[model samples]
Target: MRQYLILLLLFTLVQSAVTDSPRRPNSNPPKGFVTTKGSKFVLDGKPFYFVGTNSYWVPLLTTKEDVESTFKQMKNAGVKVLRTWGFNAINGSELAAARNSDLTYYQVWNSTEWVLNDGPQGLQRLDNVIAMAGKYNIKIILTFTNNWVGYGGSELYVNWIGGAGSTHDVFYTHPKIIASYQRYVKTIVNRYKTSPNIFAWELMNEARCLGDLPGGPSCIPGSGTLYHWYNQQANFVRSLDPYHLITTGGEGHFYWKKPVGFWYNGQFISDYNFNGQAGEDFDRDLTLENIDFGTYHIYPQYWYPQLDTPGSNFTLKAWGIDWIKLHAKAAKRVGKPVILEEFGVTGLENKTDIYPAWVDSALSTGHGIMPWQFGALGLTENGGNRVIKYADALINGASPNDGHAFYENQTTVWNVFTNAAKVQDAKSK
Candidate 1:
């Protein structure tokens, strides 16, 4: 009788442990989107598959009316997610224009420190975004910062804490900079901790240790350091809001071995050779327990500049397909869901063909994809990578002067988007 009682007690403890694991289903009623049973995402007790769009500029660029109209348009088109910017650190030069500049999102406190301005200038737009998201039944993945300087990213933080001309790695190591980031995370997480509209909190936007220029290559931090910083930041966010999911908005480019055979697994400082390959290791980063899912962004034209003709070595579409397959395989190895958070076509390429082919490959990954942006295809940025215009823009002849211009193949890509959403939704059902 005594032996049997001990056995029963052990069994109860084991079962409780299993149930208490973060990935395990909770006894409480399902509320928001969550990672369950490993790589699968569940919302309201059902599998959650999404067709999302990138509109990073929405919080800063669009007004309340424009935002409502935008979400209305997306809901009608069947888009389930909107990934937008959550942070906008003002550059020192941009402060003078903060009172009147349409782009400045924060007010400078002492020519160094910054704070969210009042009214429509700062995070009020984000508040409206969240409210609108709930109204439209759309989820939002809010990214903390950008890796580049275009929108006053890490440089802004580094400049404030470490002064200008500081290296990219300092943003991750500087004490003040890290604290500032933590403050931002805490502020936003606490603000929306109860809102079901938030799908996840992304650590940064395409975070790479790069040069001042948006796409220019620079010193890549050691893979271990990069992931460690990500882990720290992600864990901090989780501590603040344990209910929400977390992700690192890495570019998904793995760092390669330098000098032919270095056996570095990103554990020590030496693994990061400053003179060596500098980029994010998608597979390794996603392996962290703190990271709820994997994220990847591709610009085939930017990565593989050697675009081919009809039957050459490698076409842009083939490259895009290959990237998705490789990263999907990585995600499978890591047992995590991989999201193609951002991809776009160059203005010179025919998006009609590229978008469909990439979507098919993305769906094969058993997750989902979000193209570079939604809204309009405006003045090209970063070596021709442009947003895909809305279907209505193409059909209605919305020109650049009216805010955006439609590409010749924009309608075809939009069709791919709507059709893909329908098929994915059916599968989820």
Candidate 2:
């Protein structure tokens, strides 16, 4: 009888352990400006959809007057949602040109102290942004950090913890750095927890555990580590901010294999290496319970094969459409909304139809879409390629007006985007 009791006790222990493990929880509040009902965004108890843009560099890179002008342009274009960076904390010399010491939302005063200032230079700028967004009735998706080195994100954390020249994974594992990150997170969340202008709190701009060094991109650690980091940070953020939604802010590059029904040409998957891009795991990360929504970016020129190749414009367009459907289906399966948060192409040629195509897909099946960037200013940082370069420009209060302006003579594209917004507004009403 004692032996039988021991066996039963073992079984009970096993069952209890399994039951105690956390599962992905759904993050749908009943009534709010940014709640979710299943896979649809519910604003004021009505289904909400948006056509948005990334004025990510505005908080620090542009002057207060420039911020007003740019947001005015966005409002005129009917951009309902504006995504911006909430965190830019990088110091030291290697990539100093893009380091804005004054504008960093969170600063490391010394090795052990992080000065999370809300004064003129720190969180006040974001405060001003939130106020500006409210003026135009625009909701904001504020991202915390970048995964890459340009803006002193994961690399900065790694260096601060004495892991200089190490991979970004260290930032997740290092006790001291993680503590510092938590402090920063608590500070920001507590500061803006009551603000209604924020639509969501993006955990990171693009959270990846890329083992990139100072020079270039290198290998990645085990893919599972990235997912674990996302889960931890996301849950932490949700715990702090009860009012706002949360998302991982991944580039929508899938780490999972193509689904059985999804059609893909060799060039589509091979030219850009989607699976390993930024070392992301979309299938796992997006479906997490605390993650209120899923986001992906579509940058064909940077990721797809050349137009002259066999992939061709038609194939490219088809792939883009399929990518949207695939992720939308994934979100639906998990009962969450998805957004094509970033999409763009460059050149003198007109690509007005590109935004419309993606926007249509998003509205009909998904939640919404945001163009790569919008605002009066051109890509002023890092020669207009990466947003991380905004840090350097902010520190020196310099605006490098590169030629990558999304608002320059963009009448056709703007009309398509705003037209969609008008439809969404009608539905909400």
Task: List, in order, the clash count of every candidate structure.
Answer: 0, 4
User: Which clashing pairs does model 1 show?
Assistant: none
| Global fold similarity of model 2 (TM-score) | 0.79
- Candidate 1: where is the Cα deviation over 4 Å? 1-30, 107-109, 213-223, 256-276, 307-312, 376-409
TM-score of 1: 0.79
RMSD of each candidate? 10.1, 7.0
For each candidate, the alpha-carbon lDDT, in order, equals 0.68, 0.67
The total of clashing pairs for model 1 equals 0
Question: Candidate 1, residues 256-323: lDDT per residue as tens digits?
Answer: 55532222234333322122344576767888767888888877666544334455566778877877
Tens digits of per-residue lDDT, candidate 2, 74-171, equal: 88887888998878664534224433433444454345445555666666778888889889889999887777765446667776674546666677
Residue 107 in model 2: lDDT: 58
List the candidate 2 regions with Cα displacement exceeding 4 Å: 1-32, 92-105, 108-113, 211-223, 257-278, 305-315, 348-350, 377-404
